[model samples]
Target: MSEINKVKVFRVQGTGPTPVTVKISRIGKALRIKCDCPAGAYMDPCEHWKSLFTGEDQNYLDITDDEIREIQDWLDDSDLDEALQNLLYFEGHEKNMHENLARQKRALRGRVIDILISDPQL
Candidate 1:
């Protein structure tokens, strides 16, 4: 018998607080990578896994399971109303933010707007 299941988590250092979780499972003689970030949302291998496997200088911070779980739990329980309010309050501040970060924030704001408009419970 060989190691068949493993999990690793890392904090991607960037404009936003991004934590990526990687799960590797073995079946027969092959290993697979699974991640839960936007780049991996489609259930395919993502850049995070690629960087780890390739030993590239991705400049990410290694994190423990507890830290990742704390972030994940917060995301899971996030309140849409509060999130929208915060985004609206800081809407124009993106002018002073980094270009890539501002773009990500804008994209997230747009998605939240769409969700709010379409959600029947709201």
Candidate 2:
């Protein structure tokens, strides 16, 4: 069996009364992530998207362990995986240098946003 295409859908609890949906899918060699939040509507990778990768979205996520593994696998196969690792590495080593860390975050954030907007499903 082959995992040719992968998809994960999450209904995350947000500020609104109802939860919003964040859809992540693998398209060829690119990733397509979509969220129904304001930031996502503008093609921004909102906290919803980031938290999913960071595992900080557990409280808001209504998914099973198997689904979690699937998402992790999807991320592991994407370029964002390397970017996230770099971001984490910098975060740990640049704590004392707040100014430098801020700059690094901005630069890395731009790359992540660019990746998010690269292959919009719409």
Candidate 3:
């Protein structure tokens, strides 16, 4: 017989009054995440947050929790095609920065899936 064990999950929650929060929880054999940003709610990575995490680009933009929520709301209402276009734009922008083409491709695919779930039309 197999015994069930609990897995510990880590998350990166944004700072400031309106911060972007990433909550990672274990679901079955995979990890589930919930984000407070527009792209986050869609489970898609936001360029701003990604930049902060990866240090790929810096815009010096201070994102508040409210702003993150607002962005999530907007994303919830955005069209699928538009969301995909936005994702593709980000992927293209990141192409040159990532040295590993395979990693970049995987990242792009994940982003596309997130976008599709958020907006199936795309």
Number of the top lDDT candidate: 2
Off by over 4 Å in 1: 1-11, 63-122
Q: Write the per-residue lDDT of candidate 3 for residues 5-122, one digit (tens) a residue.
A: 2232223444445545554333333333455767776767665444432345433344444544433333332343355457667786787567577788999999989999999677
Error of 2 at 4 (Å): 2.8
Model 3 worst lDDT window (10 residues)? 2-11
TM-scores for every candidate against the unseen true structure: 0.37, 0.61, 0.31
Clashes of each: 0, 0, 6
In model 2, pairs of residues that clash are none
Error at 99, model 2, angstroms = 12
Better of 1 and 3 by lDDT: 1
Q: Which portions of model 2 miss their true places by more than 4 Å?
A: 1-3, 84-122
Q: Over the stretch 28-75, how does candidate 1's per-residue lDDT look in tens digits?
A: 334445677776788654556544433445556776546444433332
lDDT of 2 by residue, 1-122 (tens): 46548777878888888888988888555667899989998987676767766666434567777776777777776756787668666665777588888899999999988888996962
